[model samples]
Target: MNMKLFIFIVLISPLLASLSSFILKNKRFAEYISLLASSLDIIGAFIILYFVLNFKPIFLFNNAIAIDKFSAYLILLVSIVYFLSSIYSISYMRLAINNEKMTENEFFRYELFFNLFAFTMLIAPMINNMAVYLIDIELTTITSSFLVISEVTEKSIEAAWKYILVVSSGISLALLGTILFYLSGNIPGSANIVSSLDWTVLGLNAVYLNEGIVRIAFVLIVIGLGTKVGLAPMHTWVPDAYSEAPSPVSAMLSASLENVALYGIIRYFGIAGKSLGFGYPEVILITIGIFSIFIGVMGIIYQNSSKRLFAYSSIEHMGIITLGFGLGGIFGTFGALLQMLGHTLTKSTMYFGAGNFLHKFKTKNIKKIKGVFHIMPKTAFLFSIGSVALIGVPPSVIFISEFLIILQSLKDGYYLVAVILIGFLLAAFISLLTKSGSMVFGKADENFKAERGDFSPFSYVPMLLPLAASLILGFYIPNGLHNLLIGIVHIINFKIK
Candidate 1:
């Protein structure tokens, strides 16, 4: 009954489910196992949130696993998003079942990898040691690599290979940076290299650390992690991976793994600012942010593949989120957090809708499928709403967050950054609208066939709840949630209005 025990149980539940599933040998049961694991995880996250909001001790297992206000909020959000995405997977995977696209063994491989992926995302947020965290992230690559090729197609294999190569190379660089940092903190007199990997300790001693070494480590870490994060020039893997992976896995990659990478960047910035002054990380992030925005917007403008378009849009939003954090004030930081949360919900919803469309139309080409709303009204409606949110329209949380960031930048007199950001956002908006709007209202091809099947609650509920919550938050920020967010902003040392 102890809360700590429950927390540990939830943390371990996905791996437990995977083991049980290995014995069961039934892929059908694997979905159920994932659902159960996700449910318990969400419940545990809620419990943690409750304790944190009441200012109760949120540590578990040891001081090693503490949930401060910032992490508590993110933990709860990831749980909700992860659980919903898992449930949605049940429906999304039904296409694979019907089409016999995967052998039984391969299907079971999906079950195993899915659980491992979820488990890694769950634990990455909780780990205090940089070495341990890097290990956890490497595990993510190991788990997700199989999922990338769940289809067993030549293109899928190619995509998976590229994903593995790029991400592994990036992560290895990051690990080296982490080790160098550990070495930097080794006082010749003390045998405490491992102790330096603790984020709290590194943050405290950042001032005493060598600035040049810190800058080098930061560059290596950012470049390495930014590939996984889908930043510009380093984002080559994103479109191919997203296009080839099973829809459910694509959703998880965009929604969960991307967030995990962002979390790492946030943690690094926290330490870098305290140790080397804020301007260093800020300039790098801003430059990368601007370049990513340009790539995403330009890529989306002429994108033919629907999934690839969404992938590029995701890069743009990641850029926008980075832009907010790069500005580094209370409003900028809060807006960044809000955008991160909003994008997870909105982007996953978009992918779910896209999956349904892809299944019904049997194509990823946006031009091939038209008049979707007329044929599949619910899916079309959801897709339209998701598109609006992605474009940062009113009543979507992204709009609120983006507005705040722009305001903060202007007030700070970063006028050129503001101008470039706003321009890229508008360009992204136009690009998205062109594709989604055409698909919704245009005439269907004479050969187009509308596949009819019973839609599952798992399919709709998981995608809908997050989108609805995003809308509600944009319109009315509840007092309790607002207070919690304020606490989080302060913990991150950001000033909020």
Candidate 2:
């Protein structure tokens, strides 16, 4: 019953918030309701995490709902973003309505889809069926694409369309891969015919599935879900969409949605690794992960738009997490899990800061927006610090996580992989810091007429909270978080054992 209550709070609150926001048509009311809903979700996520850590995996309603440590972790990550984005939204949307000329209807629509997007991500990890999970992901795309165009302009519309088309194509392939997995176990020649598509059943019976088919299905799953994870080649839509979306939506997209998408991929990785012996699946992830990192860094170096710079940074960070999981050691998996939390905190902070910049300068171009420190000292401090954390500097959780992945690569005798990874990290470190640094400390335009203050307490508070957490986690890994991540590593692979 307690489990049910937790589930109810986590899943129902956002939905209720979405409905109330749409029906009320009052912007302030919508903001508070969304904030209230996200607050509830944060409490529920922590409760769920506690239960998962203390007790057995929670399976409810005839195995339709499953909450393991892994699922609980993802839930916690999503809810954190939901809460922060909600707070930041109050300031962001207000500025949009005032400065950017956003209408009430548009704000209503934003609240509606924003909460709905949070709902989809929160529920995804708990769904037992892989097909159903993929479908839930599709629901996320629909809701978030709407969010991408929340401000409603030509570029936003184009980005939304591109996001839908590319990600939808990817979803279709994932669905196809799901179909193949079911067939792989059902083929007549098999000793045990797999009777279910539930992740619980498939994971336990992975070895029984036909290896030949599992191989192809996993690759298809990669390309399909990888598109959503913002892996290179399929990541073309990410920059445009994130650049065009409202900063809150961009944070959800890069920080929360990408993690949820990658969670699906890692599930398949576990099953595929169990069936195909970690080598094949690990290679695929490593190869793709490295290439994606290369693409992300290259994009970062050449990026002109502030939002787009961080969008590409999202791609790069996702690649690192992917590489960590692909390495598949205790250090690797643990690092990847920790990295998820760090990325959530820091990326949201960065995007929130970016949103503040957008409202202040009325442009996304990095060069055009100058002297943030002189204009908005509070935001500049947080944004500058957030960028350092984002780029994996020392005493940041990102730094620790990236270091662990590097350690794992060397431990596994992937010397060349380590070398290349270090090089890319260096390039990203220089490029991101230089780009973001200029905006913060460079000279302000002489004719600039915008106000010299931050937007509101709401704007900087959200950024301050996450940036602090990200830094703290770097200096200290709380015992509970450490235990939780270790549990997840055990869940993902035999390396921990």
| Candidate whose TM-score is highest | 2
Query: All candidates' TM-scores?
Result: 0.95, 0.99
Tens-digit lDDT track for model 1 on 254-298?
A: 877887887877788888787788889988988888898899899
Q: Which stretches of candidate 1 lie over 4 Å from their true place?
A: 187-195, 450-454, 494-497
What are the lDDT figures for the candidates, one per model? 0.81, 0.94
Q: In model 2, what is the error at residue 328, expressed in angstroms? A: 0.8
lDDT of 2 at 61: 95
| Model 1: how far residue 235 lies from native, Å | 0.9
Whole-model alpha-carbon lDDT for candidate 2 = 0.94
Model 2: residues >4 Å from true position, as ranges? none
